[model samples]
Target: MDGQREREGRAPRRWRHGPPRWNRWGDEEPRPRWPWPSTVLVTAFVLFGSNLAAHAQETERAGLDPFARALLFMTGAALLWRQRYPVPVVFGTALTTLVYLGAGYPYGPVFVAVAVACFSAVVAGHRGAAWAATGTLWAGHALVAHWLYRWLPPPGGPAASWGQELVIATWAVAIVALSELARARRERWARERAERADAARRRADEERLRIARELHDVLAHSVSVINVQAGVGLALLDTDPEQARAALSTIKDQSKEALGEVRQVLDTLRTPGDAPRAPAPGLDRLPELVEQAASAGLTVEVEGKPPHLSPGTGLAAFRIVQEALTNVVRHSGSRHARVRLGRDGDTPRLRVDDDGPATGAEAGGGGNGLAGMRERAAALGGTIEAGPRPDGGFRVLAALPLDAKPATHVKEDDR
Candidate 1:
């Protein structure tokens, strides 16, 4: 019901298309449109004493008082605000009916007031009041309505209608059951919508993280290489124009490659299915990295070959080695480095060591370089430990799952 939307704070008045449709008898209807029951139900009740007089001349039914009819009509009119004041309406109608019955009014369809009131209570989320109304209606039907008819003798001395009493009681309790079922259905629907909203948020976070990793990997590698080539070009520019020209050419190549990788990452976001993926960089490129370091003034040694891994894992391994070498060139003031590849216990491990002092950059605690590496390793269910070695240098060791399903956005404490 749209009223439930209002209760949930959505301000459902905006969705109201027209005046309350009388046929809003179903759960799918927005406002729980109840039949007014104003003119018809009370008028029917008021005519009961006259009808009984016509049927049995000797029967002494209570003559209808103007005040009793006044109260009855008032009870029906008050039901118009049931949606806004459900509990109050139910209690108000029930109290007014009690007064009317006590004032010696003939029994008619007055029980319809309680039935409609109880149904309204349940729809408006007043379960406690609905149950209270159910008990009140049952008691009034069993005691008051029964005695009102059997007060004086009729011609045949017939008892009050037991079958009619049962029918009225059954209708009151049936309305309570119907209201409970509607409440349960609306609760279940609300829960499903919440779950869908949470899932959408998780997907958005994952996409943002993947793009961040791509940018960090591509930009860090290219910028480090360009830094070295620019330094080489400046050093050789005075007397050796030939080598300076070569270094400039290498810088141009690095810029083109970085720009191309950046473009591919952006395209993947815009046209994911249609964009052609470049071969993911992996440990196979380590030799080229070593040669590039050799061009710079650094000595490097490789220990073993890379193991087979998934694409995400392979890219993580490549970036770890790339970041390690970049730190060696930029922070470790040493010329010699060692890279070892092997299995550590049950997982694939990568170890990059260098005979250099533990500078702030190489110590692996501050800035995006170390945080990005940790993020990558943890994304594929892995860990990285980097610190100064006891032998007076920095050592970075990372271990990863042999085969891991790519996970969503990762956190440092994910493991």
Candidate 2:
């Protein structure tokens, strides 16, 4: 978990500030959302051209009113900055439209600018502000239309009434509703992405746990055996020539086998297409393991026939004994230890107890090895109990279910 936090903290510093200047040669910042400045420039030309056409058409009936035409042009130009300050832009455009309407200028281009402002506000995550601005603009439009038509009523001006107000309200609501929908979709995508990342992290943690267990089990058992054989070979070299040669040969053989098994377990990290090495040592190697430990200095007591266990169960049993013996050698300060491997009904039981110095000083306590043992037992749907015995020694007892399915098992069967 600590490693995970460190990785997460470092990931953002690399991404948020963008690539450094040296890496900028081939990389580019994300393009803008609608080429906003270009859009504004093109919109200005179109609106100004339309307003000019309207002014020319009306010259004969009411003469070209340069003042109102100029106001309409300015209002259209003001819309160019709507994205930066949506509410203010909408308000300014609405006021200019009011002035133009009051002065008998055209309405088409003013309506377009008002619509653009409403959409921009909604898109900016300001739903309340958008509604307020839309309401103000709608009121201004109604007031201006009423006043303008009072003097020179259109053919259907009286019928227009408050119905025009309803139309403006509907348009504003549609713009806000569409923007809200888009925002909701974006939020959903973000949540799903977060969930996926969390799941991936959890899977990675589980994998690390599995690897740690494998390393502990393999290294602990093999190293302990090698240590015992090497000690026996050195101790008997001059006193017993025949025994010394046998002990040295045992050391060599054990060392080679340990190296091979360690390499096999490590090869699991390779690509799937790669060939697997030899299988891991399991209960089948228990006698040889007990012999190695016995040679070191411990008196291992054995009883009952070793069961024909599945690969996973065998490895679990082997590791339980290995860790227990390692603890005895390292912390027990005990010259003699006893290992009991047998079956209790359907469960395979492994018990390793040492008649060592049980005082607080000698009982150095189980660290990660203890945690690793518990994890292994729990993963096998079994349980382990380890503590200082009342008689003045440390005892480790693990009972693993032989029938536990291979898929649910933690440690891999491969060596």
Using TM-score as the measure, the top candidate is: 1
Could you tell me the C-alpha RMSD of candidate 2 in Å? 8.3
Per-residue lDDT tens digits of candidate 2, residues 289-357?
677676556667766667787887788788777777766665656767777767788788888888877
The lDDT values for all models are 0.72, 0.67
Q: Residue 18 in model 1: shift from native, Å?
A: 17
Q: Distance from true position, residue 12, model 1, in Å?
A: 20
lDDT of 1 at 395: 84
Error of 1 at 282 (Å): 2.4
Cα-based TM-score, every candidate: 0.68, 0.65
Q: In candidate 2, which residue ranges exceed 4 Å CA deviation?
A: 1-132, 139-160, 228-248, 272-276, 280-282, 302-314, 333-350, 358-367, 399-415
